[model samples]
Target chain A: MPPESTSNSRQKTMVIVGILALIVIATAIALYAKNKDEVGTVTENPAQTSTTTESQASGSTVEYKDGTYSATGNYQTPGGTESITVKLTVANNVVTTSDVTTSQTSQEAAEYQAQFKANYSPFVVGKDINDITLSRISGSSLTPRGFNEAVDAIKSQAQA
Target chain B: MPSSPRLRLSQPFSLKFEAIGTSWTIEVYEAYDRLGDLQKSIQQRIAAFDHVYSRFRADSVVAQIAREAGNYRLPDDAAPMFNLYQQLYDLTDGAMTPLIGQALSDAGYDASYSLQPMPIRSVPAWQEVMTYDGATLTAKRPVLLDFGAAGKGYLIDLVAQIMVQADVRHYSIDAGGDIVTVGQTLNVGLEHPDNLNQVIGVAQITQGSICGSAGNRRRWATYHHVIDPHSLTSPKHIKALWVTAPTALVADGLATALYFAPADSLRRYFEFEYAIMHEDYSLVSSPGFPAQFFGADS
Candidate 1:
């Protein structure tokens, strides 16, 4: 009778421990699911922000009409104020051709004009060759000099 | 002895003829009774030059050299011309070479004007295949030598010398677009590579020669006369370039050199002024290059 009573107390304690362990495991699972949901929301915010930023960039972008354009700009040089005319041809919003004409009012500016180098721009217009009376033309179509000093040297060498 | 009467004409005396597959004009301010003699002499000189240098001609000295490799005698005038070519070849690191004749012909610029491109072989270096010691050009193998780069300029200088020897004080020679002016300053138009009817700018030449090289003309199938051997393709970065030097030889040679190297590099070896037009139509000129650009409004 004493042995039977002891077995009954031990069974009661085992049942209590198993029920407490199940409760603790259920609470830990619930906290883990909540944390997973929060993590998912945090990652989604950056994707939303990236999409909005890209749309804003597209809205602010400028598109240019394809055609020829010309403008004149003036800048102060050491000599005086010099005006330059720029001509450009734009295609697909990109400059395809450019030409710059410098008109220097002061003689000093004119002297240094040769050093002026034009960057790639959209200026594309120029005077027609037919409109002007050119004394001569330089190109492949017309085809066609130190030579004296070299010749003199050659002649003297031959005589020697 | 009675001298020939020098007739002061209201207009300059001019002679026009066709040679070396191009038109040539020789103009002088004063007319001479010996104009016919002068014309004959000029024709003979050009004929001799063409006979010796023309690779298109089967009987040309260059063609003979192409047939077999050996030591060949070149003309006295070849000294300065060859020297210039050697210097340019060294300077450009074989970018500009006379050995490009084979490449040019292979690209369809041949004696028969085939205008058909074939498989191109890399051009052998000048040092490897041949040796040019002033007068004698020794070739190790049969190589086609092309003087098309500055030959015309050298010839122009030679023709000018002929004129000077003839006692002509003021003269201008135009072979196609290349012009040499003496005792006068002439306004020269720089032709637009894209549009022949218009000019991009104007330059003044006085007692100097101005020569231009462009990709617009003499081009076929994306290949122009100027070819880089390393790539075996025509240079397309530059649309056109013009060089002005005391002699036409320097101007003409440097015009081709500009396609490979910068103006500052060539200026170190030769005294010349240059204007380069990039493919985008951007203009770059030397500080002393006497040129004026016409904008859209002009």
Candidate 2:
């Protein structure tokens, strides 16, 4: 074989090996990052977090601030004092979704709270925060008042 | 297979709201994470049922069936309802008929709630006009399905079935007056049609259903909504009737049937406890019914 031809073949082999090395390195980095990301997610899920436990024990769960807002509220009922926690997702200045959790000492109160959530959330879902007018929601008079308070807190936080 | 998710609700719980244009109270022992979802589902089911059975809506399936002649495919969930309806029809000797819708419209309790009976046509015997062969519902002639007697009660029963499937052991569903109680013994007052807020009797039961029929609330001009299918006029024989049975559907149908059937003839249809208020201001009750009249109370 010609000396120049031999040298060119050797260079081509070296280049192919280098390209394979780069591909392997890139794949390793991607797989490591993905695993790390999965670990982070499992460790940081809000529902399973210490913060969530603390807030739940204290009668509320607050979460999701970027484009979403959460606040804890208190209300008075014939059964005494109870707490309500609301998490709202906002898009285009309108409330998109609402998740409400009520911390009540009585099963009856909790059930009432669930009814309030089902009834009132629809009216608030697509409305702007400034226009929310709470009313007597399916005999759940107190929860609506608490919802108003929670909305007020979210408004103050978002400046919307 | 993945094990079913467990819902760890403690003690007794209740949920109250409105649907199908009436108040409803639901009490249950256990609730789940998806209780709100279940409530929404129930609301959707009721709305869908209303869309099919509502005579008020011009576009409802019943109204459409009345307008468009010939055989039509029944909705999937309609088979059981038709069976129950047929049983009531035969048991009541055609008095508790789905064929009464036209007669009711003629008497003025119409889809428009105009409260005027300008019935375009008279309703004949339901068995003669309609035929149901399990899968298909055919109208031999133009007829309307009122289903007013048992629809609401059947709906309550359907919802109860859903709750039962979700592992709910103790529950009570009170839709306006028609009630279904499970695992709770409740004392129900039988209302007098002529006397407001005055009950002629009271009944108690657990794991059973009760429903009452009266012309007290829905009356217009000189007529009440409860029309006798045969005469096309409200039956004055019994002013009000309440029945208790294994399910709300049967209880409601039996209450309507009592308006037509003689007191003794009812034993052939089903076993239930009932109370009837006669036109002469007399109240009679089954031996098992827990009844104490206002004047009879010592």
Candidate 2 ranges with C-alpha deviation above 4 Å: A1-160, B1-12, B30-33
Q: Give the clash count for each candidate.
A: 20, 5
**What interface root-mean-square deviation (Å) does model 1 yield?**
15.4
Docking class of 1: incorrect
A1-160 in candidate 2: lDDT tens per residue? 2355664444333322322232223223333434454211111112222221101111221221224444444444456656555444444433355455568876756766665554333221122212322111110001122323443454466695
TM-scores, all candidates, are: 0.70, 0.60
Error of 1 at B13 (Å): 1.0
**Candidates' C-alpha lDDT:** 0.71, 0.59
DockQ of 1: 0.17
RMSD of 1: 25.8
Name the top TM-score candidate: 1
Q: Which lDDT tens digits does candidate 1 get at residues B1-298?
A: 1222452776778899878766788888776678888888898899999999988899999999999999999989889999999999999999999999999999877776665689888999888999988889999999998998999999999999889888887789988788898876778999877667667888987689999998776665557789998999999888888999999999999999999887887787889999888754556788889888764333
The Cα error of candidate 2 at residue B288, in Å, is: 1.2
